[model samples]
Target: MDKHAQKIAADLLHLRGQVLSKGDPVALPLVSSSMFHLPGDPEGAAAYGRVDNPTWDALEHSLSVLEDAPCVAFPSGMAAISAALFATLKAGQTLLIPSDGYYVTRLLSDRFLSQFGVRVVQRPILGFADGGFDGIDVAFIESPSNPGLDLCDIHAIATAVRKAGGTTIVDNTTMTPFGQRPLDLGVDMVVASDTKAPGGHSDLLMGHVATRNTALRDAVLDWRKMSGAIPAPHAAWLLHRGLETLDVRFDRMCQSAAIIAPALADHPAITAIRYPGLATDPAHALAKRQMSRFGFLIGLTLDTKDRAEAFITGCRYLRPATSFGGLHSSAERRARWGDDVAGGFVRLSVGCEPVDQLLADLMTSLDRLMSK
Candidate 1:
């Protein structure tokens, strides 16, 4: 592992839940109470679950440590995204978003935020760095953008946005904090869907927004409280547990992807392939400079939707699922979700399967598709 990854692994291993006394539980306690008892003064204590919870405090502390900034937890990724947008943007301000990023984000900006009189501009991932930030009040970026796997220079974009008196927020969901840290690169805020890699298991829905600016952090926190976007205590606890194993799980997934990306690149069945880990990938240089590790997602295209479906069905290990960053490997055709990709475009999320076994399974599936 690289030095950064090694350091993250060490830090994650030493993370411990908040300990109030000598006999406090070593594991993170799941305090599921909706309202805390306040016999005395409730001024400084948590009065209601909607405002705050001890479980969330512990989880957010751990997340803040990982992100190197303060964090606020949310019920889901969209909730976190919404909090960031609503907290920072005003009705007349302009918001810049990736045209090819997570489809839901675009939908939220176009269908919902637009109604609020927020002028939204859509730019492809490659255009972010060179695309002037003039008149933009906020910029939302996703490096190594979803499905397409394109990368942008986060530091450059952040610097430009800041110079223009704008806030920069990055969706670090694809590359979890273990793999990338946007705050260190000068981003104003970092939002992520913990449901992906950080949760590791596909069992819970959770997300968080992290930032070093206290005012921005409090703004997002207020949004969560007012909108009732807080995550359940049990889900928060599960996510905290999931963090313990994230370093190892992410390492294995990246390692497997490094092998799988190259092996599949030259296949006759694949018309195009995009994995930043591959030396031939267009975004490889930028990915190496800005990201600590190449992510697990691989974008590839076949000739037709039937060929893509056949490959997914023929594989023994890869399941057909929309979500990525789980224990089991999975894939999905992006066009089905209106991602503006070809009908045969596939987004493959590498999992923790044995490398050799996983590669063989992928090759077999491709070979079968070629045969048919």
Candidate 2:
């Protein structure tokens, strides 16, 4: 790695104590086709800001190294997914998505793409033994899906899709590239919401797409130009900076999450604990095969929606909010988003906080909920 790459990597690895000094200013790099050329020389100044920016270039380059695939940063994770889908699928083509897909992707397919002669099919995400993917033009799979926390057999499904002459896309948002690298495991492309782990501080929002195929990269670039969904240079820089410490932050959070998941599994006030690390998790073996870390997100279904609400109100440490994979712990009632996720289900985004402190807060919250 070059000096620049090494600097970024070092920052990421030692995030625990590193702080931006007063003299260090985080500025957005100027958008220039060629920084060496005069600004008045339009031809030499490089392409339009839409195509490239130094900050974004730094992020893209860093991410490319980390993922070991060509990386493209976008305004949001959904935008990366949209751009990839738009670039790959066309009118009169069919796209197969998991039946229980991410709520946003499901909404985008059902509401927006249908009018463009695009057909979105919902394939069952049942285990490999079930042969869930029978026919599909492109298969989109999310292992350990949102809210439901179900796992998909990515390797098996990807093998089936390739044998049938179909494309495969994996949403690696929950696992991030730190926990899993789908491209190495035979998937064509991997998408992530960098707003989570990659931007560990939770102050920025961005997304990324990495693929080994050159043709697909070109297609996504074309779609990105047309859609005007490129992220601002500043956001890209933040993502790049945050990625430096991603492994450390996730390591801490995963350790905490592993402890919390099984501890809550048989809690008297808890109905069920959804975490892939658990031996009882439906996708345990598959997750163990695909992911290095079990991840920091955890789901708990309380006895009832009312009790769920009570638990939400009772929690003192975990903030009642949405979004996960941040420096601070956050909790959310899934039904608040109309997810059909059990009313009492509370999703937890475990952070780098002391695990014992978090556990105490959780136990107290459950006890309070039971009292009510």
- Per-model clash counts, in order, read 0, 4
- Tens digit of lDDT per residue, candidate 1, span 1-372? 677667756776566733447887788778989877889878988899899788899888779878878999998898999999999998999999999999999999999999999999999998876569999999999997987999999999999999999999999999998788999999999999999999989999999999999999999989988889889999999998998889899989999999999989989999999999889999989888988899899998999999999999889999899999998999999999899899999999999999999999999999988776
Compute the lDDT of residue 34 as modeled in candidate 2. 28
- Compared to the true structure, candidate 2 yields what TM-score? 0.88
Question: What C-alpha lDDT, on a 0 to 100 scale, does residue 15 get in candidate 2?
Answer: 38
Candidate 1 overall lDDT versus native: 0.91
The TM-scores, one per candidate, come to 0.97, 0.88
The 0-to-1 C-alpha lDDT of every candidate, in the order given, reads 0.91, 0.79
> What lDDT is reached at residue 277 by model 2?
94
| lDDT (tens digit, per residue) of candidate 2 on 135-206 | 566788887787677887677778888888878889898877767778878999888899988898888889
Off by over 4 Å in 2: 1-45, 127-135
